[model samples]
Target: MLDKHQAVQSHQKKSSRQKLAKVLLATLPMLTVLGATAGLSSCGFQLRGYDTPMLFDIAKTAVIIEDNRTAFPLKLPLTRRLEALGLDVIDNMTLADIANNSNNVGADPIAAITVNNIRFKRYELVGVLTEIRLVLSADVSYQTIENGKPVTLSNPIQVERSYQYNEASVSTDDQQGNQIRDWLYDTLARRITDQYVAISLPKVAPASANKSSQTLKSPEKTTVIVPSS
Candidate 1:
């Protein structure tokens, strides 16, 4: 009886140790996974090519207008609208201001810019058993940043958008075409403006220590535009 009791006690101790070991082995992988997830969350990674504001945040700004490939001209429309959105509005800001191919020559810092879209569409009627209709289209490529270097937030340069006109809705073909073009122009302008301002946050400039930096020289400066009471 004494021998049996001793044997029983030893078996129970062995069983308990084994159970503990099993539990530890099961929990170790889960703990490791949790720790890895927490580490990534703390890092706060942002997606590549999400549009962030350039103005107010970045000191200098430049806009680049590519040559129009489409038959219809949208340059004037884009320029007027973008200027109203609060860009510096410099005419022919040198390529250096926009982007620098050579790092040594131009001192101008490159500015973040975006090209929204370019599109051309044509409607055609074809004979396939019964008059089949086909629409051929080409869309402008939109991109968030230029050059291989990442923008402040790695905003992408090009994204896809769709614009379509239905001749069935309008009485005149000219009216339909005009409406579609207007819609496309307006949409493209707003998209560029929204993305440009989205990532930028306001920053206050620190006061300069040098007296020369603080002062602006103006010999012929006169102001007389007070509202009359």
Candidate 2:
């Protein structure tokens, strides 16, 4: 009787594992779907049907500097970013080419833009010797060709960053300052790109108008059900 009881206990444990396995198998597909949905949502994935307008519709573009003296740090990164965005950045174009409108090649038009008046300012914090605010400002102008006439759109972009001063460690503070400067350069470059793109893109319709149109097109439907005895 004891041996039989032990055998029954072993069988019960085996059965319990089999039941758990079946349950897991039944819900595995649902768990997988939920996980995939969560991952996609977290990464901000969206369907790709829209065309984002850009400053230079043409494949090639020339970035000219009206005042090259103070824009050295910004020029290289800006050019690289433009190239990364599928623009063929022609750095070899001279100022004369840009001025004469000769940068525009036949059939393949070249968009020319100028960046100037780059300036940097630092302000010390009141009553605090260990902190400073840094400001970077620059002027951007895009030359647009309309009816064989050149039109320019100019805008100013500025970015500010604050850094805490460490009086104890001069080396560390200097290193941090350099890092901040590089960060400022990158931020300014990205802002300049974003401003241009925003200006160039077509204006989108308001959400309320879109909702009204959608409501008019497809009115909501309702269904009613009755219980029978």
RMSD of each: 24.6, 11.0
Residues 102-218, model 2: lDDT tens digits: 544555556666778888899877554578888888888876555555667888888889988766654654776778888888898888766655544434555566778899999
Error of 1 at 55 (Å): 6.3
RMSD of 2: 11.0
- Residue-by-residue lDDT tens digits, candidate 1, 120-172: 54444433322222222223222223343435443323223333434444453
**TM-scores of all candidate predictions against the true structure:** 0.38, 0.61
lDDT of model number 2: 0.70
Separate clash counts for every candidate: 13, 1
lDDT of 2 at 161: 92
On the 0 to 100 scale, the lDDT of residue 6 in model 2 is: 98
Model 1: how far residue 181 lies from native, Å = 0.2
lDDT values for all models: 0.48, 0.70
